[model samples]
Target: MIASDARLAINPNDKVLPSFSHMADAIVRMATKPDRRSGDLLLWSDTFASLRRLFIGVGAGALVGLMVGLNTAIFPGLRAMSRSFLTFLSIIPPLTLLPILFIAFGVGETAKVMLIFIGTVFVISRDLHLYVLQLPKEQITKALTLGASDLAVTYRIVLPQIMPRLIETTRLTLGGAWLFLIAAEMISATEGLGYRIGLVRRYLAMDVIIPYVLWITLLGFLLDWLLRLAVARLYPWYRTGKE
Candidate 1:
């Protein structure tokens, strides 16, 4: 017979780390219960606020990046003018600008939104520019041969095709977008997912921290899924071409 192991028979209360069951219970309780300190549900409200900033920041960035990329690809003059500046901007660590942004924007919603925008715009623009350059030159020549004006070629041809690529680029940059959003919120926000996590860190609240982190991950996954579904539904040609 094997010797009985005392260590393996330790009481639950004696354990230093929580069991898997305890963690699961913590997550569930967190979802259902109001915050002890505030007597309010912080999760939903923080999630909404973070999401609002995310949408505004990312939406504006995507639109601007799309325009910059499309024009840079079509016009050599704009490419020459903007390429070096964009490259320089992309290389700068965006987090390093957080203090400046807070100073300039006064720690308001604008600062948080602008952090995400400035972090993501150059990356999306550069990626889209590269994608645009890879598109066959023959398509442009064909349009011109058929007497399509520059505007017609751009809007009627290039824009539609690049829509899928723009969505794809946006999806890819979302991780970084979340990072920037959280960083901004952590630095200067009264209530947000990041702010809550930062607020609870002093107390070593793993229960709240873990759940919030998981919620952020779930939100990111959902956004990526929605973007993918949009590409499939709105631009079937892009998906078929990939396959």
Candidate 2:
């Protein structure tokens, strides 16, 4: 009776209405079937925990990127110095620095955090410096004429205007940080997805390795999507071309 009613609602005389009703019935039957792995709550819990860690890592990266980017924009000389030093460091693979990091900081959380920070801060700072310098000259002139101090003008006018770009640079840096985490974890991690992957790789467990890679890739995608959503919400003025 419900199927007939739905068909009637769709079209009084359309022959396709019956086909639609059958499709709806099939969907209902599929929905009513019990999930075979209904008892695997532990699996779901572990998955959620892993996801939480990924989110935390991405958030930390974004915060570090934002601070570094802002510092670069405000202090061009510092940006130049950072660029030169970081460029030289980049020539040497981060994995090569692992031994030095371990010797200096030990195989601890500090070394891991520093590795992530080092991989991210330079690129974010450079992008931010370029974006800030590209701001309209007229905007700076107007702010100066209005008796605003250089710092005040930058903080109030310039920073607000370039916030969207800053958010974008942050998103980019967060992606880099994810890559860094894998390398950092490889150094001496006792735990973490990267460590798990390293352990599995020794035994040539392709099954475990594939799932770990997929999990991390999914996490990266989710973090990027969330950041994009945040940018749209916080800076509604930027207008994501979503008409």
Candidates' C-alpha lDDT = 0.85, 0.64
lDDT per residue (tens digit) for residues 1-243 in model 1:
011123224653423344555557766775678978877667777888999999999999999999988988888898888888878887889899999988998989999999899988998898888888899999999999999998898889898889999999999999999999998888889888999889877866665677688889999999999999999998888978567
TM-score each candidate: 0.88, 0.68
Model 1 weakest 10-residue run by lDDT: 1-10
Q: On residues 1-243, what C-alpha lDDT tens digit does candidate 2 reach at each position?
A: 565568667786533324444545433432354436553232244345444444565556556655565656556686776756645554555556667887998987677776665665556556666777777888878889989887887678877877787677767766667676777666577666676667657866444555566667887888779878888899987765754
Query: Highest lDDT, which number?
Result: 1
Q: How many Å off is the CA of 115 in candidate 2?
A: 0.4
Off by over 4 Å in 2: 1-93, 239-243
Q: Residue-pair clashes per candidate, as listed?
A: 0, 0
**TM match of model 1 to true structure:** 0.88
